[model samples]
Target: MKVLITGATGTIGSAILRHCLQEPSITSIVALSRRALPQDISSPKLSTILVSDFANYDAALLSKIASADAAIWAMGTTDANHEVNVIYPHTFFTTFLDARKNSEHRSKRFRYIRINGAFTVSDQDRSLWFFSEPRKLHGMSEARTLELGKQYRDVCQTFVVKPGGVATSGAGVMECAGKLFGDGAVIGAETLGAFVADLVVHGEEEEGAIFNKRMVEKGSALLKGNK
Candidate 1:
């Protein structure tokens, strides 16, 4: 199997790449990022493509994707300030769906996994008002989740991982504070990576499904037991 990973340098994304590289079934990998890949996990089967533009993707990228069987998209910005939170998540989901639609390897059914928030649901309205608006923006997240779920319904096998809070060895002090104080729990990136590898190799059906952190942890255990 060949895989394409976007935002391959992120905490969770990097973990997935590391685990996939060690999988004998994964013959090749293409990483898309704004900068060159870090040398920490270099391998012959892995290649990196630098891309800064997300809205207008270059057709040349299809060559790399042509050899891939799946894509793990981990590109999302955390800037909830301004209109970033509203825009970035929706854009990220659409880009992956659009890219799959235009790929030359359409013959190969592509499996796409995206990192989403745990609270995002498929149903509910979000038209609230006042200073409490930002707190209620979860409806925006949920709507985006449902939008992506619908867009990729039959086009690709989609998996939405709703992680609570990702824990990485390199996490900064601010992240640590949130992990300790926020309404979140720590989930190791390695565990998340392992699940990604299993999903790629096993070809599990997660289309329109939302797997929260606890669900993911339990699912991983169940998969391991079945294996």
Candidate 2:
């Protein structure tokens, strides 16, 4: 299957890209990033596109993206850029959805997997003054994206993955301790990537949202062929 990945240069995104490259079922990859991917990673199935503007899409980019069967959205930020967290995703989704409507692909549903934080609030009206506004904006972004998914449920299938603090490599002692003591302490980037790739390639049809611990459990089960 052809898959389009955004934010391919980020931590989890890069890991996901690597995992997708290794998956035999994935025939092609369109990685969209602000900069070109590293020179070390090379594959005949992989193509990288430099995207300077997320809010606006040219015909060339839209046509390229329209060919994909699925899209993995991992682009995010901890900063106060509401545009990046909220507007950009909404724009990207609408653009892709429109393109899909015009395409003649055989598949009825276009899968969209979004990477979100564990703390994101689905209810936009819920009050939480303790958290920063920027963080709340992330929640808003999630809510807006889900809304679009519902609006176009007939054509677009959206899945939101909420992972806790992601470790790029081996977890430290404190991180391990947190994992043992806490509910959603942290998860390895490689593990997250593998889990997401599996979902894209082999995930069963069911719910649309997945949390951190459940992500690990389900992903592990899929890897073990128990799912």
Among these predictions, the greatest lDDT belongs to 2
Tens digit per residue, CA lDDT, model 2, 106-222: 356888888988876656567777565656777778877888889988888888888888887664453465469674767777768878998887654774777778766665565
- CA-lDDT, candidates in order: 0.64, 0.81
Q: After superposing candidate 2, which stretches have Cα over 4 Å from the reference?
A: 122-131, 172-178, 221-227
Question: What is the Å distance of residue 21 in model 2 from its true position?
Answer: 0.9
Candidate 2 positional error at 72, Å: 0.5
Top TM-score prediction, candidate number? 2
Off by over 4 Å in 1: 81-104, 119-142, 169-184, 213-226
4-55 in candidate 1: lDDT tens per residue? 8876887878888988998889999888788988888799999988877654
Model 1 root-mean-square deviation: 5.3
The alpha-carbon lDDT assigned to residue 90 of candidate 2 equals: 82
